[model samples]
Every structure is written in C-alpha cells, then in structure tokens.
Target: MLNIVEGVRQYAKTDRLAVICGEESISYADVEKYSNILGNYLIDKFNSDIPTVIYGNKDVMILVAMIGSLKSGKAYVPIDTSSPAQRMKDIIETVQPEVIFNLSDKEIMLDSSVSKNVEILDKATLMNLMIEKSNTYDFEISREKWVDNDENSYILFTSGTTGKPKGVQISTYNLDSFSEWISPVLGIDGSEMVVLDQPSYSFDLSVSTLYPGIIFGATLFSIPNSLILDFKKLYAELKKSNIKVWVSTPSFANMCLNDETFSQELLPELETMLFIGEVLPVPVAKELLDRFPRIKIINGYGPTEATVGISQVSINREHINANKSLPVGIPMPNSVIKIVNDEMEEVPKGEKGEIVIVGPSVSKGYYKNPEITNKSFYVEGESIFKEKSPVSALDEKLRLRAYKTGDLGSIDDDGNIRFFGRKDFQIKLNGYRIEIEDIENNLRKINEISSAVVLPINKNGEVSHLKAIVVLKKGINESKLKKTVEIKRELSKLIPKYMIPRSFDFIDEMPLNTNGKIDRKKLYADIVEEA
Candidate 1:
C-alpha cells in the first residue's frame, strides 16, 4: 500500500486540486510545497516528536498543518474552533506541546493560567515560517527523520465519561493498514474523485476521508460547520460539488434527505455513501435506496481506538426490505472481530457478546495513559482460549493484539456482525435487563416515527424506567397528545408492555455531536431537565 508521503509525492507532480474549502482551492503541488515548508520549519523549531496542537475547523491550512506535523515526525492533535476554551485548555495541559498552531484567522484568547512557555503561531506567522524555511531550507528531510510505522501519526482526543477527554494514539502502521482496507471499500482509485468532507479535523470521522482522499489524489470538498446549519446553502453547494463519495454519519444524510431534491438529480455523480460513528437505521438505508437506487450505502462500525472502522458491509435492497435491524457488517481484511462474553470467552455464534477487535488497525493505546489503556487493550494467547477454538488460528496469525470495544454484538449465520448496542446501554429495571437500542429500533419501526433515541431514566441511582425521544415523520402532528398516545400504543405491540417507554417525547430532530452521532449525553441532560 502507498504510504501518505509517497502518495503526496506521486500526486505533487500533477496540478489536480487536492482540497476545496468554500471559495479556496488548493492543488496537490501546493499542498506538497506548503506542507514541506511548514514541516521543515517545525523540525527546526521543535526538534522533537512531541505532538503539536492544531486549533481550527475545516480550513485548508488545518490539512496543511497535519501533513506538516507528520513530515516533521510529530503527531498532531486537532482542536475544533467551536470547542469551549475550558476543553481546549484541558487538551493543552494534557498534550503540553511546545508549539500550538492556531489556524483560525481570528485571535484566540487564552486564560492567563495557560503556559506562556508555549509559542502560538497563527496564519501570518505560519506563512512567515514557511517562507523563511523555503528560502534557505530544503523541503525534503532525511529518511531517518521520518516517523516509524510504530510511532504515532496523530492523537485524536475523544470524550471521556470522567469529565476529560482521552487521547487515542494512532500509529503510522495503524493508519496505513486502515487506508489499505478502506480504499477498496470506498472504491477509491488513483482516478480523480470528489470525496465529501463533513466532519471537523478533531473528529476521527474526518480521518475516514482525509487520508484516503489524499492518498488517491482525490479532491476533498469540505463543508464548513457554519454552512452545515444552513440547509439552503448546503444543498446549493452539494449541487455544484459533483461529489462522488458521500462520507458522513447517517444522521447528516437523514437531515439532507428531508428535502425532496436530495435525490440523484442533485448529485448525479454520487456513487457511494459511507456512514459511520453510529448505527445506520433501517429507515435511512431504505430512503437512500429509494432516492438513489444505484448508490452503494455502506454501514461502517468502529471507535476512534480502532482507526475509524474495522467492520463494514454495503446495505443492499434485500437488507433494507428484510432485515429489521441492519447488520454492521463483516470485519475489514486486516482486522479480526470476536464477540465474547464477560469472561472473554468467545460467545456462540448468534449470541450477543461484547465486540472485541484484534488486528493491525487497532491503535497502540491511549497516549501517556497506561492505566486506561491496560483496561481496554491487551494481548491474548493460547491460554486465553481453547486449543481448537475458532479464533485460535486467527490469534496465532494476527499476534493477538486486542481492544475491548465495550459494544455488544453477535455474528449471524452469514458471517455478518449485528450490533446490539453499547454494553453500558443495557440497564436493569424492575429485575429485567433491557437493551436501549432494542427499544429504539422497535420505536423507529413505527411508520410515524422518523428518528428515535431511548435512554434509561434513573431514580435513586438506579434505572427505574425508560424514556424515549423521537422525531416524528415530517407531516405528523407532534404536539397532539393523541399522536404520542398512538405511538405508545403502536410501540406496545412491537415491544413488551414493560419494554415500552414510560413516556414519549416528540421532537423535530435528534441532537448530534461533533462526530455526527446522536448526542445521547445532551439528550440525557434534556431528559433530566424535563424531569
């Protein structure tokens, strides 16, 4: 597989556009030259592999900073511009880099408590550094200066339940492996293609498009966060984007699908739709198929620790027509997925268990966090499984580096993996264990319900009952008391009386986090406030 640097080197000879953000367009040669100049400057300044914190959104320079940091042999931590100062401060303290690349054109005011030892460089300073380096320094670095495959390529900070974010350290080897597996899945050839870029650099979901698009020399059509909120402008851009591959969370697509014009007519060249960061609801898949009959809708499943996705499968017409809950799909070529019970023993096929991934794509571990890393990542050998166990051969072949996904799933007869839900989402209420997704899935099956999220309502520190928040079908009367009663009645027939939500809250749409997944934390807070 061609590494990122090699891909850039090959593409740099051509004048094809590599990135398009708003009215700004950047070519492959410009990307190579600018990144190299910035990289050489970074090398001269830092002279170490300490990660540099890149603060910005969907700017072209954010990509430049990322490539520059990699060329300088340092991993980069991307902080979104919308993130609260406190969150940014926390990351600053955690990574504690010598330099911070502030790509935003506006000045970022930081607290006085922030370290003064760290130098902050904005757009002008960054340009000066590049120009200064270009005049005297050769853009190319010696081979020894290049980061090893085992060394970190980037550190993506993800939300932690403990009120801080944990950094997921993805190595060069991990990224290369992910690119190799996802390239074919994305149908990316060297031929020019426009890949949609929706998520910000901070979110690992962006990695899904950024690396592969760069490697294939495809132009990335980036949609800024501000434009995403304005549907009128967003669709207008989509019509002109000529986007071939649509990469986003299912929620984003569902939002776009609300308009009648979001069909193939708007983007005739659109061939592939890749959904990740959450379960692809059956209704969303069915609608996409209805609108874009020839489009390939692939459902991918993985956490940040697993380098974007480890399992994926294309949603076919059969899956939409027949399956109640769509399967996440088979494991990627470089990865091995096993469903195991509490004791880490492989569960019987078709039985629900925690999803454990063992493979090349698995990240090294959380950066500078051995305790949390040890809890989630490990190695399993012969002693952990029976001699003739089904996974024993895979363990031998793959060397058994594993990550406990904390997600519950099971493999079906056809080798397709079905996601049950998060293990933590399972709650015990009134002496019964229930999966939240089970209720959510059944709730979504109702014709009037467009999107549904189920959460356990806690009473006295225990799950006492279930609460549901649903987005009704566009024309449905959400405010009517009878509408909710009817929804509850329909849900009762699909689920047990006890499993039916105690109360239903109807909304126009579900809240989405930066990564485009349903923002359950925000929803839970809303539920708490209502209670």
Candidate 2:
C-alpha cells in the first residue's frame, strides 16, 4: 500500500505547489518543512499519541497540522471556524486532546468554560514556533514515529440525531485504499492539474480532493466560505483559478450555474466535475452537460463512514436525456455494496433495501463509542465482489469491514447502483409508506420546478403532513398561487394523492450546509419558528 505522507514528500523534492487559497500559495517543500517542524514539536511536547484538534477553515496551516499530527503518530480532528463555541467544546470534551491548534486569525478563547487545561496554539504563536523550530531542529524524524496503517489517521465528527456529534475514526490504511481507487478515476495525469476544492476542511468531501490531489502532485485551489457567498468575486476567482478538476456538491454547482458566465469558457481547463454529499438532480446534470459538453460529470456515493466515496460513475448525455433517476455507479475497487432488507437478507436486484458497504474504505467505526459502533459497523459473513475487473489481485486477501449506511438503494439489472434516498427519509402517512425522494424526484420532473425537497412535518411525535420546498425555474412568469396549483396538479399524476405534499413553499434558493448538502434541519427549524 502507498503511504500518503511519503507520496507528498516525493513531490516536495521538486518544489511543486501543493495548496492555494485565495492569493496565498504554499509549495510542497514548505508544506513538508512546516509539517515536519510541527510534527517534531508535537512529539517532543506531548510524548503520547493523543489526537490533536485543529480548529480553522481553509488555512494552509490546517493541512500542515493534519500532516504533523499523523507524522507524530497521532490523529487530528479538524473543526471548522464556522462551528459554534459550544460545538468545539463538545468535541474538546470528547477527544480531550493535550493540544489544540487554533490556526485561525480569530482569537478562540477556551478557558474553564470549554476546556480545563490544554495548550492552545494560536496562528501568531504557531508561526513563531514553526520559524524557531525550522532554524533549530532537523526536519527528518525516525519512521517508527509515523502512524501505523491500522491506527486512526483522523477523527471526523458528524452530526448525530441525539444532539451530540459522533466521531468517525478513519485509519491510514482506509485513506490509502480510498486514494488508490479515486486517483485513477479523477483523470489526473503526470502533468500538473489545478483541483477546485469547495468544502470546509471539517467536511469529509475535502478528503476526496485533498488526499488524491496531494498524492498526484496536483495543486488544490480552495474557495473560502466568504468568496463562495459572493458570486461576482467567486466567478472572477474561478476564471483565474484554471481549475481542471471540480469537486463539490450538486447544490454548490447549481449555485454556480446561476451565473451565466459559469460556462466552459470561464473554466476551459476543467475536465472533470465530481458531485457528492447529496443526490444530483437531473436538471443540474443536464445543465452542466449543456454548458460543458466535453467535461466529465461524475457522481459519487458514500458516507463519511466510508473514506470519501466508494462508488462513482461518470455521467453521460444518454443518462441526462433518459429522464429517469441517474444511477450512482458500481462499487469501487476493494469495496462491496449490498442492498439488504431488515432481516439482513439480500433483496432482489431491483428491490429497494438498506445499502450496506463492506470493504477497506470502511472506517474503524465511531471513536470511543463501541456500543454505537457495534450497532452500525461490523463484518458480515464474507466479502463478495460482484464485479471482479476493478479489484486488484493483491486485494483479494484484504479483510472486509461492513458499515450499515442507513441509505435506501438497490442494484439495477445492469448492475448499476440506484439510490432511493435515506431509510429514515421514508415516512408513514395515513398507513401508507412514502419515500420523500419519490415526491421530490417526481416534483422535479415538472417543467417549472428546478429543484425540490420533501420534508415531513411532525406533529407531537408523529409525522402529520409532508411539506414540499421547491425552487422555480428562472424566467417563469406565473403567479405563485397559480404555479403552486399547477405543480400540485402535475405532481399528482406521477404519484398517489397521499404522496403529494399538502403544502408547497417556493424559495429562491435551497439552504445548503457547510458540507454543501441541503440543510433540512435548518429548514425545518425555520419553518417551525415561522409557524
């Protein structure tokens, strides 16, 4: 297996630029030097393998800290600057790191209220340490201090239904497996390529671009949250970025498409557009194809539990014109996806069931919570590979670890995986089981509707009704009341009367979270507050 740190080190010798955020750029040489200095500092300071918490956004130091932590045989937990103080407190309590690297320019005051006794390295202090250590200490460290492949590489905290976050521990071996599979699919050659990164460091989506890009010596061009919110500035930056590989959520892409200038002309170097974190709507796929005929629009499917993505398929004109839901694609090499029922029996090829993933990319399970980990992550009978072509001969002996994704999907007759939405998204209304995706998909088929999301409105403890939030197409001159009636009428023909949402809400744009997925939780909260 290839080591990620070694790969970056190989590129560092040539002085290739590794990361670019706004006007700031860092060469691979600097990245290696800074990270090594930090790693040595960490090893000397702590003398233990406790995970370090890196608090920042897209700052270059965040990556340095991540690499430093790994080099010191410790995992790093990345918390975005946008996160609340309370959220940071929760993670601090959970991990209880000896050191917290605050790489942001903002002063993050963590006293007894948040942390008891922990060293906080602010940006100014960290920079001084990096400079002092670089002049005084050697960058080379013994290989024995490097984290073992099976040891945790990073602990990513994800939102939990219980109001507390659950950390998913991904091992170095898991990341290496993910990089092995993703590197080829990303269309990167020996030549340098500029990769567009749109997600926060905290989000696993960044992993899809960061690790693979670094391994291939591709420069990562990141769009900070501020720039992303400003369309004029964002488009100007995109035009200048020369980004060849675009990685973001469908919602972010759709937001970019809102600008007429966001065509192939602006990003002529773009060769690939990767979508993850949510279902890619047909309209969004079609619009991109129409704008960039030569670009490969790839859709990937997986959760943070699986290192970035486990399955991916390049979208084509045929898939866009089919007027049907697009398939998520076949399982990547060294991974197996099974659609099974509640009894853990495999459902018929075309029948919908819970999507379970088993393979190397699976995480070590949630950190420090064995009860929850045992319930969600485990190994089944044996590893089964439906498609053998992509699997490497050497990977046959790899032990399979299974993760219950809680996502409803099925394998089609052609062996393509079709996503039906989340198992939790299925609502029981008046004794009829309804898939929220079904309602949303059918609603999107309406000519006037560009995007739709169906959310259940709960009364007391039970779902009382369904609410459909939609974004109308541009240049539609119809009145809101008239258009709502027409959409309801059109949607009724495709779905049962009971499946249609009782109320319709038209929004100018869908709210997307930091991960770039639809913010259903925020939407529901806003709706409740408005009521």
Candidate 3:
C-alpha cells in the first residue's frame, strides 16, 4: 500500500499521463493535486473513516474522487450512472454515506426518494475545488489521513442472491496484495506502458487495471460506457489506443473479436490480454492466438470477496490441445486456493469441491451485513472445520481470513485449479455477475406478476443472454409484447438495466415438478425446444 502512494508521487513528479477518457486526459500531477484538494475539502465536512458514495461512469474525474477519498481516509463506494434509482437508494441506505460525489457533469436527482442530510459535491463544486483553491489546499493534511492496512480502501456492491446488494469491503492490504502480485505476474516493470481500462470502477474487474496501472505508473486508456455503446467510436478508440496491456472480460473481448478490424493490425503495440468475470471460451483463446501470436493470454479467477483476482493461468498451444476447458490456474504466492467438501475438509486433488480462497487478499467481509458475512466469510481459526484440518501451518496470512466462494472446482496434483461454475442460481452474462434469484425476487414484487423464474440462455458453451419465465396475475389483460414492455419498464425502476431479461415468455402457469416448487428444468426444456 505504501508502494502505491509512492508510485503516484513518483509519477506525479515525472509529470506522466495517468488517465485518458476519449478526448479528456488527466496527468499524474493533476490527479495528485486535485485529489489532495478534494481530500482537504472532504476532511472539513465529515468523518474521515466513513465510506463515501461516488456516482458516475467512465470519466477521468472519477479517478480523482477515488484517490481523494482514499487520501481523506474514506473508502469510495462507486455507483454507475446507469444503475437504477432504486439500486442507488439501496446502496445509500447500506453505506449511509455523509457525502456523495457526483463526478459527472449531469445532475443526479435524489431529492424526493432519499431523506438524509447528505452533502453532495456536484460537478461544479468539484470543478471549484480544482479552480478556487487548487494551489492552496493542505496536501500534507490529506496525506496524513491516507487509507492503509486494514482500513477499507473501497466498498464494491455486487448482486446478492437474497435480492439485495452486498458491499464487499476490500482493505488497503487487500488491494496492495492484489496489485503487488499481479504487476510482476503481468510483467509490468514500472515502465510507461499503456493498459486498457474497459470495466467500470463499480465493478471489481476494473480494479485489476486501474489500481495496478496507477501503482505501476502505467497509462490507462479508458473506454467509457458511451463509447462502448457505439461500435464506431469504440473501434475508433481502440485504433488510436497504443494499448500494451489489454484487461477486460471475455464478453468484451468477444465483442471486439466479432469485427475483423480487431486484430494485431488494429493494436500493433498490444502484447498482454487478461480476462476475468466470466468463462473464457476456448474459441476466443484460439482466435486471439491466431490473430496475435506474439501476445500472452491469461485467464484469472476469484470473487469480489477476495480482491480482484487470486489465481491466473497463462494460455499456450499445449493448454489449447490438452484441455476441453481452460483452468483458472494456481493460486498467488500470498494466497492458497483449496478445494474443500461440505464439511470443509480438503478434497483430494482430482475431486470436485467448493473453491475456498484464503489469504491477506480476502476482503474484511461484506460491510454492515454480519449475518451474510458470517455465512460466507470466516477467520482461519474461527471455523471448527478449518481448525481441525489446517492448511499450511507456516503460511503467514493463514490466520487472516478465508472466503467460501460457492463456486465448484477441482485442483490437479500439479496445483492447477479448474472451474466448474457456481453451486447456486448466480451467473455471469455479458461480463456482469448476476444472481437469478435477485431478479426473480424483484419480479415477484411487481403487482401484476404472480411468479417468475429467470434462466440463462446458453449458447456455444457460454450464456448468450437471459430469458424470463413469467406468469401474470389471473385477470391481467394485455398483449404479450405490451405486457413485456410494461414489465420491463417497471423493472427499470427496481433493478439495473443489465439484470433485465432480454426476452420474456408470458405463461399461463409455470411448470411444476414432483416437489411443490416450480420446475425450472421443464421450463428450460420447453424454452429450448421452442427455440
């Protein structure tokens, strides 16, 4: 963590570029200067230790706010602008922030719904921090409160299977563990390398790029949501980006691979591509190898509970020939990836079991939600199962923490770990981790809906999209298309746009199995048969 702060300082001294978003760019000096100014502003109004919600998409200003909040000893909670107002309200309720930074130029009206005495640093106000007293802020005072060690650096809210959002609290130690380990692994050597920043700050995937890029003094070429929505602009950005390191999900890479222009010729300087947040299909790996033979392709795996990632595998011709599916690879030196049974006993190398990650990188746990945190996370000696069968006794961080990822996996005798998806109703579609039950829970809340079952429509070994099996109330009179539109519009009020099903099947009644529960298998079969 100290290295991270020093890295920023060194880069600022060098006057190198830190972030680039389309036409806008923020240099290291400005990022440091503005963040210090903003940090000083934050220290005046609120407790330095509380989390502050930062609302925006992919703008350079977002980075300044993040660094500033960290400098002021407050963890920044990122909420994307595309997020539903209800979702935003849920986060505000969870974090109970005293201040919210509206980094974008637009206004976010939370006037009527939320009742709180929250201070908002709107765009103009934030700009004023840079304008009014940019040269006279107490940089040393903000630096004195820099977030470190066990203190939460950032709180990322992700989809909860219980229908609420879970804020995973990654501490400065956790971020430091991740960034330090991945830098050398990715072969970043403090050079002026350009890395791609595709994911939003709200998502942990972006942390892999943003933090490491910052700490390593690498230039980040940010692709905002607006440019991503327009292929012409997205490709245009790519053509111009002298990207040496590519970090994005397989879904985003697949989008780029769909166009013939996304090849070595388009990004001649590109050398490393890292993928996570979803399954990396073999076809994508094969195509990338064929197109850019000189580039290195790596697939990483871990949950938000354990920093950005804990394990990684660099793919090659042998891996392509030897395996049907890719492995997430071995654990980092600072962590241990174990396959454990329901009893929490270590499963034999070749046997399938729950993937458990233990290390310093594991998050402090979900913020303010002790019930769920106790269920999913645990300290090493705290668990009877873990105490009975301890993993590596000499391991330094063994006593720190461990996260029980509900993901199924198996490790070979050689220490390579392979993933077999989740043990619950959660799925990743289009690079977004989603809980199907969360959508189902929200759907049942709609007055017109009786019951809903959300299913991932699988295509070519990956989820193509989501389909909802819904049953309306007894006398709701509307066409299927009209009802779908209406239902979607209502959903827009309850959840993020990504969680909404791409297609809907309005059914008179949901199929039932021998048990009283709705038969998801039957509905899935019926849908697949129809297609």
The best candidate in terms of lDDT:
3
Candidate 1 backbone clash number? 0
Candidate 3: residue pairs that collide: none
TM-score, candidate number 1: 0.79
Q: Which 10-residue window of candidate 3 scores lowest in summed lDDT?
A: 382-391
Off by over 4 Å in 1: 111-114, 382-399, 425-531
User: Which pairs of residues collide in candidate 2?
Assistant: none
Tens-digit lDDT track of model 3 for 1-531: 334665677799887899998888999988888887888878776755888899988888888888888888899999998888878888888787888898765676664435467888887788876888766774654355888777898999999877789899988878877888888777677899899988988988998888888998999899888888899888888999999999899888888888998899999999899988888999889999998888999998988889888899899988888868888888887567778999999988899999998787898789998898999888776442343345444234433588999989999777888888777788888778899999999999999899899998888766788999888887457688888899999999989998999999888898888888899999988987998
Measured with C-alpha atoms, the lDDT of residue 57 in candidate 3 is: 85
lDDT of 1 by residue, 16-46 (tens): 8988999988888877888888778878878
* Clash count of each predicted structure: 0, 0, 0
RMSD of 3: 3.0
TM per model?
A: 0.79, 0.80, 0.94
Worst 10 residues of 1 by lDDT: 386-395
Off by over 4 Å in 3: 1-3, 111-116, 142-144, 382-399
lDDT of each: 0.80, 0.81, 0.84
Highest TM-score scorer:
3
